[model samples]
Target: MANTAVRVRLTRGASEGDVAALKAWLERERKLEALRSSGELEIQERAGTQDGQGQARPMGAGLDIMLVLIGAAAPKLFDEVYEQVKSGVRAWRENRRDVENGEPPEVEVAPDGDGR
Candidate 1:
């Protein structure tokens, strides 16, 4: 009978579309998981539908925040965010590999021709 919301602002390294889509996906995953864990998601919504339509779903499906790129930032804003996330994930994996190999955990990412 209740709902919740989570607002997140990536202070750096996130584009408008990335933030929007990520926020929406995260919110739904969190909500649905919470509802299922709490035993709140009923499965009868499609039972009475005449042609596959069903009861209303919970929460709106879109970003609530404005996603305006920083006008003063460099023109390759989208690429920057993509590379940053990719590099971060790579570094995290490298660190884990280092740890598993009985070595010190180290994090570093080299650019693949795109500025990072």
Candidate 2:
């Protein structure tokens, strides 16, 4: 079957617990089991990059969490998964002081090209 990847970029870095919560949520999505079984469903965290000066930086820190999906059904299933993941991220961000004014995290869903 054909496969595609959906990249979910969050507005802030996600903690390990947050990633686990998202993983659990995705695991419970039984309707997407086929994709999971085929090894198409995946979630990952992208850490912030360091500056050229070797100092710690938060550039693109917002584009932290990423979700990868594979399989021919991925296209049709993207919206549902994106919504669920975004909801989860928002909830996760609410309690973090790093989140601006405690506002819900913004999420951007896009195609994961190059499969990195």
Candidate 3:
């Protein structure tokens, strides 16, 4: 089975707290747990930003999240989970009065080392 990596770039208006809550939700997500048990999912999180001087700053309003999956069925699994998560994120953002209307987070799938 091949391994695939999926990267999710959060929307610009998402606060650090939003990212934290999303991370926590993913941790306790039942679907993710099932994927973990089946040996098909691995998750990594990247929060904060780089300063103009190239310094790593503290957590901020935007973050990136990565997920690695293994198995022949990984692509399909990623799609399913991504849709569910994206929907949840949209709902979460809608409830927040601080965020402005704009493009939502984007998910990119990397297959064979080329991100598309």
Candidate 4:
């Protein structure tokens, strides 16, 4: 079976702790069991250097994650994954005063299209 993947990248708006929390939640949260058991969903973390941050931001890679959906997934599945991730991050940022501001860090999620 072929596998499609989506990369979820976060900016400095998310702290190291936040990244760890998100990874843990997505991996172990009971709420996500349905998605986990579907055989259509899989998650992974990748490590790499953060390039092009310029002078304003730091230059280092954060703990970014990827979501892999097996087989030919429907468009709605993408939305479902996006929402799940956003919800997870939102929950993590809720109580934190520093990141609870009007504008939180940016989360960019996009499909790589290369079914491995």
lDDT against the true structure, each candidate: 0.31, 0.53, 0.56, 0.61
The model with the greatest lDDT is 4
Model 3 per-residue lDDT tens digits across residues 6-105: 5555554556655666666555667776886788877667652653334774455646556667767876776676665566555554644346456443
Candidate 4 residues 44-67, lDDT tens each? 777534523423346534656777
The model with the greater TM-score, 2 or 4, is 4
lDDT of 1 by residue, 1-114 (tens): 111111222322333444344434432444333543454321111111111123442232222221112223324443443344344444444544455554322222222221
Off by over 4 Å in 3: 1-3, 47-62, 94-116
Q: Any residue pairs clashing in model 2, and if so which?
A: none
The candidates, ranked best first by TM-score, are 4, 3, 2, 1
TM-score for each candidate, following the candidate numbering: 0.23, 0.48, 0.55, 0.62
Which numbered prediction scores highest in TM-score against the true structure? 4
Candidate 3 — worst ten consecutive residues by lDDT sum? 107-116
On the 0 to 100 scale, the lDDT of residue 7 in model 1 is: 20
| Top-down lDDT ranking | 4, 3, 2, 1
Candidate 1: Cα lDDT at 39: 47
**Two-way TM-score contest, 1 vs 3, winner:** 3
